[model samples]
Target: MKHELKGLYAALLVPFDKDGQIIESGLREIVRNAIDVQQLDGLYVNGSSGENFLMNTEQKKTVFRIAKEEAQNEIKLIAQVGSLDLNEAIALGQYATELGYDALSAVTPFYYPFTFEEIRDYYFKIIEATQNDMIIYSIPGLTGVNITIDQFKTLFENEHIIGVKYTAPDFFLLERLRHAFPDKLIFSGFDEMLVQAAISGVDGAIGSTYNINGVRAQAIFKEARLGNVEKAYALQKESNDIIESVLNMGLYPTLKAALGEKGINTGLPKAPFHPFDESLRPQLKSLIQKYNL
Candidate 1:
């Protein structure tokens, strides 16, 4: 578990029943696929792709525990412990850290227009409480909270706040972040732009699509970082095709369906998020076979 925290990680997709319960069996299978089959460097558990926001605290803890047990320290695990309730975030951070998660990540608190000072304090409290390495999860599209370079400087002041899951499409900001914090680990959160981010010098990536297309993702990152833009771009284009289809069909459900086709028992997305459209099943199946996912 003391592995280098820099590499391709699947932003883990959870298997949930219609009752919004974690399907433990399916979860184990998915973990094994990521480690033994996909051969990803890590698993970013309970992040957005796992529908963390939709699960209760205890359910989140269940995911943390299950992922750790299944992984058994074979692969790196970064638990996303962020919540609107600061205490919940801290408690989950403590839970994950104690469970031996390699690192803890928290999305910027959203829903209320929290001040920058308040946001800074949120992360500080979690780190102080858990005393574990932290990765700032910066996804501006969902949270609407953009951390500028100066703000990042303030956050990085906490030596324990190791790096960030940079999800936005702002290449300029990414280049600036790389130049500004060369020592910190910067993980690209968007799969479609993995090549671009790798070209811009991202240390690694954490992506939802990696759950299905991880081998290609790893190749894209490796080739791009090695200055093989042509080779990297080729893989990126292939990945983008899969991503474009998945997004159009529905993200979580389509992913679950893809895994289901492989007999993984990936149940369904939590409520309010609709299940994969049965009408699109043929297209999803075709995508899976076409890409050999």
Candidate 2:
């Protein structure tokens, strides 16, 4: 269990064609880049970076199947089955489990002020149905729901609630969690704060940027773990420069654009999220040149 996960994972970004249909071939290219070029530890399929929320049921399953098929034992895979719909979440969980995903992560149900018990039970039901290890996906910034330390403790009581993909910026809670649950897996979510989280003792990190810039992120995590703060900080600073540019340009689109530079054919972002701004191409290219991404 300890070795199943614990390293950098690209929260995969999916590509879509003009008609808003998934470009399967492009997605396979991204997976190969992550494995062959970036040499990442793993891939986190169908998460926020995948523009998952914008996709429907069939599309999500398609991503799970494609990622699993492409990755195909090359590296670990965590399927993000979280959805606003609990039934959908459970169904996805079972599907991923059947596909033999390394683990299943579900975002805390959002859009309503659900009690901790409600949230806790949601996780329980998914675990019971799927009978697979679960990682709590806590990104309060996006979900508008924050799980307290006590809430995490309660959830972890089940043991099947293996760890968390903690996406918030609260280092205090991060430190507390590290000390409190030394045995569980904890993957940091933000690329900009990778060094900080590594210093705080997270098991690993998952980021959208890792899809293209994982070579540098791997260096950052390695330096920090080796107690080389100065080098790690330097790398973190450099990575954040790229992340800032990506965020400014639009996270998914800008990331796909980086892959596009590598001649991977990663398509544009799904509908309503807008495309890579043609005007921003030069800025993104500058980042690619600077980072050698």
Q: Name the 10 consecutive residues with the lowest summed lDDT in model 2.
A: 1-10
Q: Write the per-residue lDDT of candidate 1 for residues 155-259, one digit (tens) a residue.
A: 999999999999999999999999999989999999999999999998899999999999999999999999999999999999999999999999999999998
Model 2 lDDT vs. the true structure? 0.93
- Report the lDDT of model 2 for residue 194: 97
Score candidate 1 by lDDT. Answer: 0.94
Clashing pairs in 1: none
Candidate 2 TM-score over all chains jointly: 0.98
lDDT by candidate, in order shown: 0.94, 0.93
Off by over 4 Å in 2: none
